[model samples]
Target: MQANTVEQIAEVQRKYEELQQQFRAEAAEREAAAAAATREVEQRKKYDELQLQLQQMIQMF
Candidate 1:
């Protein structure tokens, strides 16, 4: 009975470690995706500003 209990405890610990690793990986992926989205938003803003400037210049002509 004692051996069985030890085996069960070991199994739970292994599962817990696996879950922790999976959670860490998922967190990293989420962070990377958020960073990419931020970059895209910044690029879009720059493009819009350039377009406005071009329109203004054309109007002066």
Candidate 2:
């Protein structure tokens, strides 16, 4: 009986570790996606600013 209990405990620990790994992977993916989105937004903002500057220069000409 003790051996069986030990096996059961080991199995549970293994499953817990797997779940923790899965969660960590998902979190990493989400962080990457957020970073990408932030970069895209910064790029867009820069492009918009450049466009406005160009428009102003054209008007001056």
Candidate 3:
């Protein structure tokens, strides 16, 4: 009976480790996606500013 208990504890520990690793991986992916979105937004803002300047120049001509 003691041996069976030990086996069960070991199995639980293994599963716990697996879940911890998966959580960490998901967190990292989420962080990377957020960073990418931030960069995209910044690029879009710059592009819009440039477009506005171009339109002003066209009106001057």
Candidate 4:
């Protein structure tokens, strides 16, 4: 009976470790996606500014 109990405890610990690892991987993936989205937003802002400047220059001609 004691041996069975020990085995069960070990199994539980192993599962806990696996879950922790999975959570870490998911968090990292989310962080990377957020960073990419931020970069895209910055790029769009720059593009819009450039477009506005081009329009203004054309109007002066």
- Output the better candidate (2/3) by TM-score: 2
Superior by TM-score: candidate 2 or candidate 4: 2
Model 4, span 1-61: residue lDDT tens = 9999999999999999999999999999999999999999999999999999999999999
Model 1 misplaced stretches (Cα beyond 4 Å): none
Give the clash count for model 4: 0
lDDT of each: 1.00, 1.00, 1.00, 1.00
Model 3 lDDT tens row, 1-61: 9999999999999999999999999999999999999999999999999999999999999
**RMSD of candidates 1 onward, in order:** 0.9, 0.4, 1.1, 1.0
Could you tell which candidate, 1 or 2, scores higher by TM-score?
2
Residue 1 in model 3: lDDT? 100
Candidates' TM-scores? 0.89, 0.98, 0.86, 0.88
Candidate 4 — worst ten consecutive residues by lDDT sum? Answer: 1-10
By TM-score, the better pick of 1 and 3 is 1
Residue 39 in model 3: lDDT: 100
Say which candidate scores most in TM-score. Answer: 2
